[model samples]
Target: MDEPARRGRLPLPHRGIAFGGDYNPEQWPRETWAQDARLMREAGVDLVAVNVFGWAEIERSPGVYSFEELDSVMDLLHEHGIAVNLGTGTSTPPPWLTTAHPEVLPVTREGETVSPGGRQAWCPSSPVVREHALRLVRATAERYGDHPALALWHVSNELGCHNALCYCDESASAFRRWLERRYGTADALNAAWGTSFWSQRYGSFDEVLPPRLTASAENPTQLLDFRRFSSDELLEWYRAEAQVLRASTTTPVTTNFMVTAHIDTQDYWSWAPDMDVVANDHYLDHRLDDPWAELAFAADATRGLAGGAPWMLMEASHGAVNWQPRNLAKAPGELERMVLTHVARGADAVCFFQWRASRAGAERFHSALLPHAGTDSEQWRATLRLGALLDALDEVVGTRPTSDVAVVFDWQAWWAVDAGGHPTQDVRYLDEVHAMHAALRRAGVGVDVVSPDTDLSGYRLVVVPTLYLVSDEAARSVERFVVGGGHLLVTYFSGIVDENDHVRLGGYPGAFREVLGARSDEFFPLDDGESVALDDGGVGRVWTERLEPRGATVRARFTDGPVAGGAAVTRHEHGRGAAWYVATRLGTGGRDALVTDVLEGAGVRPVLPGAGGDVDVVRRDGDAGSYLFVVNHGDDAFVARAPGVDLVTGRRADAHEVPAGGVAVVREQPTGRRRPSEEAPA
Candidate 1:
C-alpha cells in the first residue's frame, strides 16, 4: 500500500534509439578492444554494456582489487564516443569468496547444496554473499560514478535467473523474519496459512521453515508464501546493491528482468517501482508452438511493467541461443522483424546478449552482433543493416504504445494455481494467459498484460484468465470496472481462492460469482486428451463445471459431458455493462469466437482494422508524431494502408508494402488521410 522508492530515468547520451549489446573485452586480448570499438562505431552503435560478469576479474581476493584492465576499456570506449551501461560486476561471486564461505551456496528443495561452478550459485538470503557483493558494487560505483562514458548503472546481469529459491538454513531464517514482518504474530500467520488443516500450526516464527521436500503435497499456503518471501529476499538484495550505487553515483540504476514465459519467480509488478528504467532480456525459445506470439506477449508484458512508458530490449540474441533443447538459427530477415516488433510495442533501445562470439565459454555457440566470421558474415551484415534502421527511426525514441484491452496476470495467482494441489494438472496458468493473448493478437488488437492491481478504468475490455488466487481489493476493482460500464471476460478456475490461498467457501468462483450472476457448486476436470462438445458447434477441453445461472443468460451449453446441458458460457448485464464467464476450457476457435463477440460489444478496434493475423500492428504517439509499425510475418507481402514516409526505406509511399518477414515504420501525415490501396486484402 505504500509508495515505492523512485529513481530517475536512464541518462542516455546522444540519444536516438540506443543501439548496441553486451561487450566483453575482458574475454579477448588487449589488442582486440580497439577493433571492437572501431567496428561498433562503424555499425552506428552508440551504447555498449560492459563488465556484466566482472566480479571475479575485479576482486581476486578479499581486500584486494584490480582495475587497470577495466580503466583502459572504459577510456577506450569513451574516446570512441560510445556511451557505457556499466555493470556493478556483482552478478556472480569469485572462486575465493565461495571457497572461503561455502555456507552462502544455495540449496535445492531436496536438501542438496548447489556447487559454485555455474553463475548465481550464491544464496539470495545469505548475509556473507550480500556483504561481499555489495563491497564490489560500492567499489565499481565509486570508480566509475563520475566517468564521462558512464550513461547508466546496471545492478546485476539477471537477478534470480539461476538461484531464485533457496531452502538452506539461512533462507529459512530469512523466511521466518519476513513472515513475522508480514503477519505480526504467530496466531495471525497460522490463521492465514490455515495451519489447522494438517496440524502444521506454529506457536512462534522460529518454528517455521521453508517448504522443503515432503512426503505428500506441502501446505499450499506455505508454498505460496515461500515464493513471495523468496521474491522479496531477492528484491532486498537488489535494493541493498542499489542503495550502495545511489550513495556514490546519481546515474540511473536498473537490472535486467527475465520476463519470458518460462520464468515465474519474482513478482515484477512489485519490482517495477524499484527500477529507474525497466529493461528485460528475451530469447526466442524454439520449443514453443508459437515463439513469435510468445515474443510479442513478453514485449507487451514488459511495456505493461513500464506502465506504458518506453522500455529497452536489453538482451535479445542476434540469431540462435544456446539454452534451448534445439538451438535453431534465425531465418533471413527474422532478426530485423523481431527487433522492429519490440520497437512497435514501446522499446526505445535494441540490444543483444553479447557483442562478439566467444571462442571459449559455455555460450560460445550463442549468436552475437559480430560473429566468428568477422564483418564478412551474414549475421554481421544484418547487424549493420539493423543499426542503420535504428538510425533512421530516431524520431520514435520516447513514444509510448497505447492499448484499449488488458489481460490480467498475477504472479501470486501463477504460483498458487500451479502449486501441486490443484484439481487437474491439465489446466495451466500460463497456457490460459498465453491463449488469451494469442487470440487477441490474432484479432489484430494491441493488448497490455497488466497485474490485477493495475487501474482497469483505462481499458475498455479486461480479460481475467485463470487468476485462481486474487485478493478482495483486486476482485472489487474488477467489479468496479464492470459496474462503471466496462466489459469483462473471466475464464474458468479464476477467483476461486483469496490472497492467503484460502478457498472462497460459497461457490467455485467466489470472488466474481455475484458479478457473473452464476455459481458452480463443483468442477468436472476432464481426463488427458479428452474433449466435450458444445451446443454452438464448438468444442471444450480440459475442464467443465456444473453451473447454476441466477439472473444471467446462458449463451452456450455443453452437449455431452459429465455436466451435460450445463451452461458452458454465460453473460450477465450487471450495471451499465456486461460480464461474461466461461465454465469450460474452450478450443481455439471457440475461444476466438467468444473473444470476438466480447470485443464487438466493447467497441474496441484493432490498430490496423483489416490487417491479417500474421501482420502485427502497433501505434505509438509522442512529440515526434504518431508512428505506425507494421510487421509482416506471413509468407506473402502485405500492404499497410498508411500514407507517410517509410522510415526504414526512406521513401514516401501512399501505402507501404511490407515484404514477408519485414517491417515498415510509417510517420503518418498530419491530415490523417490515407490513399486508397488497389492491392487485394491480405
Candidate 2:
C-alpha cells in the first residue's frame, strides 16, 4: 500500500518515543503561548495538538468563519519549531449550528433528550450533525492541508460521549441502511432478530424500529442488534471524516479515544483501521491505577491492530486532575516514570490535556505544562523533567511496537455480551481479558492483545475468551491460522451467535463448532458470588451459562456442584492446532492458572522470566525486531532481568533485575519480513 493510502502519516522526526502534549492556545493569550513553548522546549515537548475544541472560534457562527487568530497561533507555533497534531475541532457543536437546528440534540438512553451542555454533546447519528462536522473537517483540511508545522491530524476531540449517542431521526435512518446491507432481506432480518418469537416481524423498511430502551430490547437479540447498530453508526461517522482527510489532505488522521472505559472507545479493533496513527487519553485519580493491567492491554491491542503501526500517547497528565477527590500533585519524578511506561508499551509521542491549564473554564483545575498558578509551579517543573527526557531521546518518536502472539478479543462479542443482557449481569469482558494479560506478564510472555478480526497467522497462538460472535470471516481467519499450525484457544460461549446477533441454532458455537470442538446445547447462568470450583479447588463467580460440551474434552469443570459434571472448560484439536474453552468466570487464581495452561500448551514464553509479578511485560511487534516493555507496577523492588539491550540506558541489565517501579525495553530477535514503514498505526 502507498503511504497515505487510507490514513496519512505523521512523518516521524526521529525515534525513541515522541514527547509532546495537547496545546489549546485558544485557552490562553499569545504571551502564554511563548511561555508554553518555552516550557515545552524545557520539557523536550516536540508536538502540540491544536484545535480540538475550537469550532466556536474557528468558524464563528457559520459564514462568519475566521482563522486570523488561529493563523497567528499556527504561525507562532511554527516559529517555535513544535510539530502540530492538528485537530478539525468538531467535538463540540458551535452554538450557531445547535441553535439553528435543535434536531442535532443528542438523545439519552432513557429517551431523556438533552440540550447541548458540554463538549461531544451533539448527536452523532444526526444528518445535520454529520453535515456540519464534515464542513469543519473539510474546511480545516483545505486551510491547513500542507502546513509545514503539521505532524498529524487529530480529527475530533476525545470521540466518545459516554456512549450517549444520537437517538434522533437521522441515526434511526442510518441504522436501517446498515441493517439492510448486513441482512439483505426482511426474512434475514427476522431470522437474525428471531422476530417471529415476539410477533415483531416488520412488513417493510419503514416499520423497522430502533432498539431503544423503551422499544426493541424486549428480546436479547433486539438489544444485541441495537448495540451493533450503534457501534456501526459511530464507525460510519468516524469513517466519513476520515474519508474527508484522506481525500483532501496529506497528514495522517486520528481522533483520541478514551482508554478502555465503557465500550472501549476508539476501540483499536473497531477504529484502528481508520487511523493513520492511534492516540488515546489516559488519566487516573492518583492513588493507584493498575497501569499495566488496565492500560497496557489497551495499548497492546491498539498496536496490534494497525499491524504494529506506530501510535502516540496523545494525551496524558502533568499532574492530578480536578476530578479526583484528592487532586494530588504528581510527586517529583512521577511524570517521567509514567511516560516511560507508555514509551515502553509503544507510544510515539506524549502530550498532556492542556498545553497550559485552562485559565478560566471547566478544566481550569486540570493539570497542564503551564498551570493556572502560572510560570513556576511544581507541575511546571515535572513538565520540564519530561521535556528534558524527550530531548535526550529524540530519535525514537513515531516508532512501532514489535510483537508476537495476538490475543483475540472481539467488539462484536463484547457487544453481544453487553447487549445480550447475559443471564449474569456480572460478566465482564475487560476483567477476564485482563486476567489472561496478567498471567501472560507473570509468565514473561510477549503478549499482543488483539480482536477476532485482527490478523492471526503472524502469531503462534490466539486466545479468545467467550467469542460469542465469531463472524464467518473472523472464524475463517482463525481456521486458517490453526490450519497453518498456529495455536487457537476459544473459551465458553465460543459460538452462540452470528454477526447480526442471531443465535447459531443448528448447534452451539455457531461458526466455530469444528475448530473449537465443543457443542453447547444449554448453559445455565450462575449469579454473582456463586461459582463452580475448578478441579484444582479454586473458585470464582460463575458469570454465565454452565457448559454442556460434546466432542470437546473437559479441561476444567464446575466441581462440587449440581452442574459439576457439565463441561465448564473443554479443549479440542483441529488441523495442526488445538482450541480450549472456559465455561465460567474463574477468580484471578483460576483465570491465571487457566491462561498459563493455554500459553504453555502453545509453547510461548517471555524471552526473560522471573522478574516477579509486579513487572508488567509487553512485546511490541515491529519491522525487524520487537521491543519488549517490562514495567514494575508494584510497590516493592521489582528486579527486571532484561532480555536484550535496556533501551533506557543503552546497556544490558547488569543485575538480573531492575529496581521496584522501574521499566525496561528489550530488543527481540528479528524474524519474517522486515515490516515496511506504513502510515497507519497498529
Candidate 3:
C-alpha cells in the first residue's frame, strides 16, 4: 500500500486565484492597448491568456514568423503586473496555411472538406498540420519561454471542439493504425467490433476506416473506438506542443478542456494526465433550464478529472456566449455565483473567455468583462467587484472538498449508454447522473462525482446510475468496497458490458448481480411519456426491468405495469455493508426518495442542516482549516450561521444572511493547529 503520486501543480508563484482570461489584443487597435492594461489593473486582474487564436498574426506565411505586435502586447501586460497564459495559437491555422495545404483541412463525415472560416478547422492527425503547429509552438516557446510574466504555457485553445470527428483519408489511415495497435490484428478488431453482425468482417487492418456514411447505423463498438482515437489524436497533438514548451521553459503547460456534458469529443479522464494543471472552459447550456446545476456538475466533473487537485476555470462567459441558439445574459450577481461555485468546488483560479468585448466576428455579441458599453457598464462593474472579491479569498486556494458520498459517473458509461441499440433511446446517462447528483445537493449533502476507476474505500455510499460499461477490475473493486462495509447503489443498465463493449454472460447486470443479490430477467422499455406506478407512490419512466430477488430484500415494487408487483428497488445486506439495485428510471420524485433512504442508512449529512434546497453548500479543507462556502442560487434570502470569519467580508457573526444570487465563504475556527487531510478527492 503506497500513496499515489502527487498530481500536477499550478505555475503561479504561490497559491493565488488567477483572475483574468483570454486576451486578444490583435483584434483591437494599438491605442486601446494601454487602456486594457489600466482597466485590468483596476480590476485586480493578474493573468491573461493571449495568442489563443492569433495564428495568422503570429505567422503570416510558412517559414515566416513575426513577434513585433505580440511583443508589444506582452510587454504592456507585463508592465501592468499582469502575468501571461501564453497560447501556442495553433487552434485556428491561418487562412494562408489552409489555402496552401488544403489536405490539412478537416473533412466532414460525408467527405466534404470544411472551410477555414471558423476555428479548429484543421485535421488533428494531418502530418502537415501537426508539423506546422509544432513549429509555431517551438518558435513561440523559444521566444517567450523565459519571459518575466510567463505564468502558464497554454498549449492550444480548446482541443477537439469543432474538428473532433474528422473523416478525411488521413484520419481513416490513422484510425486504422490505431486499431491495429489496439487489437494487434484485424481478426481481433472484427471480434471486438462484432463486424459479423452485418456480414462484414475485416480481413486486414486497412479495410477498416472511420465510421462514416454507412448504409445503416455504424457498429456501436466501432464508433466508440473511433471516439477514443479522435480524443487520443488530439491529446497527442497537445502533448507534442507541451513537450516543446517543457523543453524551453519551466512553466506548467495545459490546454483548456470542454468538460461540459454537451461537449463529449474529448475524454478528459485520458487527456488530464498530459496537462500540468487541468484547466477547463465551462459554458452554461441554457437549454437545460437548470444552468446553475449544470455549472456545479461540470465543476465537480472537472475537479474529478484533476484528481481533486486545484484546477483552473480557464474560460467562462462574462454573461452569455454567442454560440448557443438563444444567448441569454446573466442576471445581476449571477456572475459571482458562477465563479464562486467553481472556487467552492476545487478551482484555484477563475477566469473568463475574453478581457474586453469584441466588435466584429462571430463572437462580437459574446459578453466580456469590459463590454461594448465601456467602463461605466454593469458587466464591467460586476467583473471588477468579482476580481476584488477573489483577491480577498486567497485562503480558499489549494483546498479539496471531502464528501461522505460519491456518485460514480463514468465518461465511458456516458458514451456507451447512449450508443445505438439501447433498450430506450430516450435514456441519457448524464441526465440520470445529474438527477442523482441534484437529489444529493437538494438534500444538502456534499457529493463528489468520480470516475469508476477511482477507489471506493473513502466513501460511505457509492452511487452508480446507468453504468452500462463496467470493466471486470472495476467490478471487483466495487465488490471489495461493499464487503469492507461501504454501501453501494447501482441503477439499471449497469454491469452489462466489458471495456470492449462486449456483453457479460449469465444475466443482466452481469458483473454486479452477485453483489446486489438479484438478477434481471429482461428489459421493458416504456414508450415516450409512459410511466409505471411504484408501490411508494412514485412513478418510474423511460425504462424498467423485471428483477428476480435472489438473496436481496425487496425495497419497492411496481404498482402497475407488465411486471406489476415485481421488485423495482431492492437492498441487499452483504457481509458488513449493504447494496441497493434500482431496476428502473425513477424520475425525480422516485430518485429523491431512493437517495434519501440510502443517505439515511449510511448516516451521511449535509454541511448545513437548514440550508435551503437552492442554497448549495460545500466544505474545502486547506492549510488554514476547513472553509464552508454557502452559495444561494434562489431568489429569496437565506441564512447560515458562520463557522468562522467570512473571507469576503471581515465580519464574524453567529448568523450570516446571503441575498439571492449571493455567496459566503467562512473559515472554520481552528482546533489548535490541525493538519489538512492529504486524502485524494473522491
Who wins the lDDT comparison?
1
lDDT tens per residue, model 3, 182-242: 9998888888988899787998997888988888877889889998899899989988898
Evaluated at residue 459, the lDDT of candidate 2 is: 74
What is the Cα-based lDDT of residue 138 in candidate 3?
90
Q: Across residues 571-681, which tens digit of lDDT does each residue of candidate 2 receive?
A: 877788777777666777776777778766776655445653666665555434566566666676655544456665667654435556665566544444332212112
lDDT of 1 by residue, 391-426 (tens): 999888877777778999988899998886778998
- Ordered list by lDDT, greatest first: 1, 3, 2
Residue clash pairs of candidate 3: none
Candidate 3 residue spans exceeding 4 A from truth: 1-9, 671-682
Better of 2 and 3 by TM-score: 3
On the 0 to 100 scale, the lDDT of residue 394 in model 2 is 47
- What is the TM-score of candidate 1? 0.97
Q: Quantify all predictions' global Cα lDDT against the true fold.
A: 0.89, 0.68, 0.86
> What TM-score, over all chains together, does every model reach?
0.97, 0.88, 0.97
